[model samples]
Target: MSKILDAFLNENLEALRDQGLYNEIDAVEGANGPIIQVNGKKLINLSSNNYLGLATNEELKQVAKKAIDEYGVGAGAVRTINGTMDLHVKLEEKLAEFKGTEAAISYQSGFNCNMAAISAVMDKNDAILSDQLNHASIIDGCRLSKAKIIAYKHSDMDDLRTKAKEAKESGLYNKIMVITDGVFSMDGDIAKLPEIVEIAKEFDLITYVDDAHGSGVTGKGKGTVKHFGLEKEIDFQIGTLSKAIGVVGGYVAGKKNLIDWLKVRSRPFLFSTAVTPGDVAAITRAVEMIMESTELHDRLWENGDYLKAGLKKLGFEIGASETPITPCIIGDEKLTQQFSKRLVEEGVYAKAIVFPTVPKGTGRVRNMPTAAHTKEMLDDALAIYEKVGRELGVIN
Candidate 1:
């Protein structure tokens, strides 16, 4: 309530509003499924990261309900303090099996996973070669480690190789790590993990991949590491249970030693309360479902393709997205926000992404078509897009 603090907040907030950079949050009326209700208006949702539609799967819901009856809702305390639960242990084991790793350790969320794991293994004496478009969590994690961060051009293998070679040859650090997102969320592009793995081997750099947007949506639902068969080559496989897995937590899958070290040293795991018993149970079941069948994953990709094709055919500047995440690029910030608003007004809830989430002047309305979306739903969305696109002059 100090005058200085009030002035600082007022000035920055006004600046953001003037520049069309301030985000307005909307509340979903019920579940965040394929169709959502906002302010009592039902709409086809295209902005969720729930890739495989597992978030609303009936079987998973039943599993969580059963778990709550048996184990209660909360886990009581941190894993180290109150001891780990059986569900927690089972989820970790399933995660390791799913990722084809020797062991795995869980965290409160995907963002916390990166923040904990990176700083635990690397320190001031180490250096990290990070991709330019990695998630904000990875960037913060590298900073937390106090390591010298060398950013390469986004998915530019040549730039990565040059940086890796220079960092290695300089002998300026004890350990060098290369980190990237398995899938760039904004562009929906898959990272070149094969090339990155090759470069890592040549430079003896420790490899870390944050596949938050890839799991349960790629590699028949195993992930990008498995998509490229780099299970053993990549040193760290980081992911979230919240997205495709449809739960609430994050994890790192790797060698037994790495898991052991993280269990002891990762601050989040050591300090934060363990995932709720119900969530842990449901996460284990979700991973099992992904391992047992690829029906959801296949349907997700089909929806993605259908949506992307429709957007492109309408003359919208859909970006180069390799996965199911589709982005309709609108260069001007205000216009992009207006486009998103129009889509929402027309009953399609595709949100505008701008500023720090991506770069200025490259605003977009990102769409994520999940497995739960039927052809009829998609057709309706496309029709809405056409109307909005024509109205906004985004497409002919």
Candidate 2:
């Protein structure tokens, strides 16, 4: 390593440490589920994004193993080459059906899908009206698209309408697209897709909803677009197979032409290796399971409600969450980190979200309660929370 590069890394890392913003990653010793083991301690995990808890489902695991046995481990080459397997086709078909779109295309990850899809369609001449609170992937994707990115206020329909009208009337661009997260991960608030769709209709703007957290948890497991019954209204519906689907991949479901365009133009799809056969098989089975039953969906909501009510009852300020994601709002960043540390020590695993993730001062401990979490597990987590809150003087 060059001495100059080492010096630069040392300086930035020290700066991060000084600001208490350096994240220390803890490895989960075993399978990530409702509960997980870290640093030799088994804790009731509330930080995982395993919404439907299908990540460790026996059936899905069996399917993945079986696929591995038949097809081996990797896709050998990029999709444009000889890597497009039958499993990939089936996965895309199922995703299209799940999102109620004409076609769908999968990527290696949700972030990859965003980076590939957005830039593939939109370009420098176009202007994108993006939600201020959209996911980082969406933000990065928009930036990569080279579009004139105009950020509208978070979930503010009036602001979106104003921006949309301006972008349309400006006549400086060939197209205008409105992109937002179907569910904002930090606050767990669902996007106002109905209002957004209306604005899109009036402005003739393309609509994109990244329903990463909404799928398998909302709309009887269909998603936020389907939740609001505007599946056909949105132009691009992006989803993750990793989160609720309990697999690993991302997809963009939309009209056939759009899908065709992405298949040829998306750089990631053209150059990157395709998703593994096991993941494809597992994700396909997971989507099929979601479409077939509401059992997991209902259970996830129940657990979310149960945990939210408990947190609220304990006098902790749980923010406005329309979904199972819960945030225990503690303003001071240091205090928030300390609070999470205490929870982990006390046998609960909730992660702290501070500056740059949310705003600087609105530091919070975000909890993700899944269908896999038993009531007993939630109750124990609540008790731990109560203790930590009192110790930290957050609750009365």
Candidate 1 residue 364 Cα shift, in angstroms, is 0.1
Q: What is the TM-score of each candidate against the true structure?
A: 0.99, 0.98
Clashing pairs in 2: none
Put down candidate 1 lDDT per residue, 213-288, tens digits, no spaces.
9999889999999999999999999999899998789999999999999999999999999999889988999999
TM-score, cand. 2: 0.98
Best of the candidates, TM-score:
1
Candidate 2: tens digits of C-alpha lDDT, residues 251-368? 9999999999999999989999999999999999999999999999999999999999999999999889999999999998888888999999999999999878998889899999
Q: lDDT scores for all predictions?
A: 0.94, 0.94
> Could you tell me the TM-score of candidate 1?
0.99
